[model samples]
Target chain A: MFFNLKDFIAEQSEGETDWEIDLSPLLALMVTLIPVLLLQTSFATLKMIETTLPVLSDAEQKPEEKKKDEIDFNLSLFANKKSELVMELVVDNKRLKSVTIKPDGEKFDFIKLQEELFAVKKKYPKENRLKLMPGDGVPYDIIVKLIDSSRVTPEKKPMRFVSSTGENLETTFLFPDVVFGNITN
Target chain B: MSIVHDIVKKAQKDSGFTLQLTAMVDMFTIMIVFLLKSYDTSTLEVKNVDGLVLPSSITAAAPEEAMLMLVSKKGVFLNDKRLASIVDNKIEAKSLAKEDEDFIEPLFKELNIEAEKIEAIAKRNSTVKFKGTIFMQADKGLDYSVLRKVMYTATMAGYGDLRLAALDGEK
Candidate 1:
């Protein structure tokens, strides 16, 4: 025979197993994919900032709630266009102490506000209602931060104090009951 | 010396060899799975709207599901519908249906229509009440003026619950 039988068989079998597949395309794909996937990954948690409670329907509202609106929750803060935070305390709907917190340059002093709030919480530990009157052109984040400062202590913990009834209470929030005074404005 | 020579000879033998892909394939599979699993897919698949950035909050409260409203620098969207255009961080005056600066007419009308739909459904279905809750997603840099307009219109349309969307951040 002109052709060698063993060599022919060896040549046919060699093509079957020892094949090294080109991995450059796969490598390219992986190189492109890893960064994309990593870029798309998010470590941050999406949260919701709870504003004032929803208005209940007339039929769903309690008599106390309806009358509660008429009752003065005398604690209020006004964020003027100059970004000054004016905290006002009213008793019997009469003008009481109006603490004006002016901003240093452009930034409102939230830390000072928090400290002031600590004092306010000490006096009216049971009062949780706060009327917020934010200015027209103020940034939304400032208002949110202001709410946070008003509701919690400077340490981000709940405000702690004793009640008006001489009961020892701790971890009570400052003023979570916030009413947007400028919502209609 | 013979063993060394044999090893050298084997190195010069057949160059063709199959890649051990099982280990690499396994690694890639694990990586892909991990990356895909890490993606956040909870609480109203709220996506990143262009020009809108959410501020981080110290509060750990989780987001709730409701009507989605997105306010970017470019425009104002309600449930993914563009209701008004914003110019210079404020909604365009032309977008206002009424002369009132606080009222965005298109937004009000759409919200009214949505309120009517919910109310109509509530009339027959006692279980489903119109809980006028709006899940607001506004840019951190946006002015309170613009947001107040939207809020005012929403309240007028009978949706009073305003939940501002924020990113859960470090304490």
Candidate 2:
């Protein structure tokens, strides 16, 4: 029989074509990385609080004509390291009586601040802006807690308010817009 | 004895087993999908600095991509570079008042350079406007005064919009 080198080579090549590349190493890598990634992955959602430096606009400088029914309910909260909170209520650019609240033990009396804010909300339900002036020594956590306290009313009465996804919730609204003010001596 | 040997050989041949890999492949596919979905990489990547603990908040707004300023108990860093150190919860006097009044010099310089670059880009691309926004991640235990100075410095350097970074608090 004649030696058929071409036929032999063709058969060998055909056999080689049927074989698949080994994926065991790649599979091993995926297995290792998947678990590590899972361990490093965070389930907690990310959120943000938008703020702006106090910039006085020209329109703000020019005061509008005041009406009889209009009441300026601008409120400012001053927090100090001595666990003291001084809340000032301003009406039409005039400072009203200031209420000083001492802390209950170590923690700042957020409940008292809430009660005072709730009373202010009762008078001006449409007023949602608040100025938070934290002292130089006040910690960031307390400021965040104060902002949270100011954002919601203490009363659990059912009122109409929009949820995050545009759904209406039966909840009373409080001061949601916060303007961080300078700490004054 | 011959009959018993033949039966044993036939049983051995019948016992040749094959593994069913379809179930394993299905499980691996599900695991990969779940891991990919659970890992959220689409948001802005803010590197966690050492000795910095962020405050927790109930705000639902997601952070936008901007310049990063990390305020730790040790120092203040911008883009992983230390701008100034906090000595007794106060920035260096030179950085605070030497060149500019009340603004940190090093921070103002760095932020001004970045602002110029951003403004140049905005000028070239009409669609891109300079929002003058910056993201600040300060330590939870840091004094408000330090944060105030940082914010003031950023504002002076043309960063009007400030986004304070905080962890998501329990509802």
Candidate 3:
């Protein structure tokens, strides 16, 4: 292909002829790269979608076994299902912020929440130390949506948890000092 | 020498000033085609047991594995099985979840069971890892306590990677 185009151009110059330049080679290059370029973009797009964590495959199931390992992080969230679109945030046993979603609105003010999350992410970028304890009967989808919404780009969002209330429950899982000194009595 | 003839000759010799945009246009056309191809496959919607609605987010990622545990507003579920909903002898899943306390005992038990099952499978095959990704599909109105409890349970279950489900524009 290269030799043909070189010769064609040379011949035109030698003949001093006003012939139209054939762009077939350039078009061919583009046509060849179409699939490769398409594949690259699609791969990235697919990667982001894949991270949403779909269901597990068969070759991946294991039977239940008990192990005594402490939780890596203690994190949670609070959603007010009684009212419309109201939610609160906590991190490392501390109340971070409480923001409200519009009644019957499809979205929440994530920009404000992102600020709160940024503060927490700045404090604990690698490990999640927050807990998410949601109220009863709040739409399950809303809770999931909140978790998805709380994430910040280029930063790790805190972990979430359901609320618990019992004296038998222990708060010494992570940063025991924070549980006792700041989050608990 | 005629002034117009001299000027015309000089202008014709100045070839550097002219640019052929045909090549540029070709490059742009190829780039546009690639960009369109690389765009993500629209978006996907997933549901839990109770039909609780979760807003999907653009940040929600696709994973190599598809082991998602759905925590609905009603109770804790895996693939939609009721695992635990009681907190201190309570049946409600929406009540104020205890905060800063060990609030994930019941939920963790269920998740740990599932994790062990996966681990056992991985052990048998020796080709897969038991580490499945978790997508937390929490409601928008969930309180801090309940949210925390759910988060704690997922982390304790040996699922370190987490994805929060939300609508795209919301974030």
Which stretches of candidate 3 lie above 4 Å from their native place?
A1-185, B1-45, B48-51, B56-59, B62-64, B86-101, B104-106
Give the per-residue lDDT of model 2 (tens digit) for B1-171.
Answer: 344335544564688633333455567778878787768764455456777887888643677788788899889888789989888778777677755545788888998888788889999899888788888888889988888888777766767787888778864
> What is the per-residue lDDT of model 3 for residues A1-185, given as tens digits with 9 covering 90 to 100?
34698878888889876555544445555556566666545332222222211232447677656345422333444445553443444443566556564544544454455555545444454443334344555544554445544543323434343333222321112211111011111
Docking class of 1: acceptable
Clashing pairs in 2: none
Between candidates 2 and 3, the DockQ winner: 2
Every model's DockQ: 0.28, 0.27, 0.14
| TM-score of model 2 (CA atoms) | 0.75
Which lDDT tens digits does candidate 1 get at residues B1-171? 344334434554655444455566567767877888766556564467888988777753788778888999899998789989998987988887666778889998888888889899999999988888888888889888888888888877778777888876563
Worst 10 residues of 3 chain A by lDDT: A176-185
**Model 1's DockQ?**
0.28
- Against the reference, the lDDT scores of all candidates come to 0.76, 0.75, 0.49
Please tell me which model should have the higher TM-score, number 1 or number 2. Answer: 2
Best by TM-score: 2
Give the distance in Å from residue A98's predicted Cα in candidate 2 to where it truly belongs. Answer: 2.4
Q: After superposition, how far is residue A185 of candidate 2 from its true place, in Å?
A: 8.9
lDDT top scorer: 1
**Fnat of each candidate:** 0.54, 0.58, 0.24
